[model samples]
Target: MALASPTVAQAQSGTAAQCQTSGANSVPELHKEWILVGWDKPVAGQSWDFREKLGKYYDWEANDVVLYDDMSPDFQIARSPEEYRALWESSFQALRRAHHLVLNGPEVIAGDKLSTSTLEFAARLEPPESQPIISVRARSTLVWRCTSDGWRIVREHNSTRRITPEESRQLFGF
Candidate 1:
């Protein structure tokens, strides 16, 4: 007999309905949904596609979204939808040029009107000619709010896990 695949395994064991079904009243499921649609899908997009998907999950009307990253000292603040569009547009371009992102641990908590997710992930930057791929791990906490449409992110704070210079050199190979 053939072994059941992971997708089939979850479905057959009733865990899929418990954690994959929308409207199933499961926190894990909602968390799973948010993470996939919010981060995973956007990172997988190319060129214009990433921007399109970024707008979907972000709350444009709030007009107070703040994105934090390790590369900058100040927050990447977007006070308006136009600015929001610009930030993500530039972000997608950088992602397209510099690195490939992958999502890892997503610990989520669903609340009455707001939810939070702590995501641990890494980006593998394309290296020079024949150098080994360089990877950097970071963690982000995302704040989500329920809207008439659905859940949307209102704030995001991302920080790189502290690494020594030697550790960075080893991993990134300078």
Candidate 2:
């Protein structure tokens, strides 16, 4: 499948509505739902119950699943769903509050049994005990496969950079 390039206008308009309408396919919609269930809602609710909510989106028994998250340590290459769960649970422990805002595409390329998408986002995170808030900008690419159970992520890579306080203020209105 060919990847569709976003127009300058579409690139600048990073609203949820824009994301939903940018692609004329079900993959984009499924991507949005995946993000909402896996990240957005749990983060918004400040809940650490990720394994349960995110279980359906992953093939826990698959041997080839992988994740690379830059924010994690050198040992953060999770090759199994259990390892990913541990990583997420560890991250959640340090966060008192976290909010993620989608900044760009789920620009997607889809096929009969496989699809991939890229997403850019900004996050505001607060640490426990009233520590100062931290803001980060990040991007991620996810590969999903159509398994008998449904669409499940088989690979993911994410990278993040800390945003300056001033930049955070500009982006998040703090």
TM-score of 1: 0.56
Model 2 compared with the native: what TM-score?
0.76
> Cα deviation of 166 in candidate 2 (Å)?
2.3
**What lDDT score is found at residue 89 in candidate 1?**
54
Once fitted onto the true fold, the runs of candidate 1 whose alpha carbons sit more than 4 angstroms away are: 1-46, 72-75, 94-104, 127-134, 161-174
State the C-alpha lDDT per candidate.
0.54, 0.71
Q: What is the per-residue lDDT of model 2 for residues 24-60, given as tens digits with 9 covering 90 to 100?
A: 3255666665565456533433666667757777768
After superposing all C-alphas onto the true structure, candidate 2 shows an RMSD in angstroms of 10.0
Give the range where candidate 2 is weakest over 10 consecutive residues by summed lDDT: 16-25
Question: Number of the top candidate by lDDT?
Answer: 2
Residue by residue across 36-69, what tens digits does model 1's lDDT show? 4443423333454444645656677785666555
Root-mean-square deviation of each candidate, in angstroms?
A: 11.9, 10.0
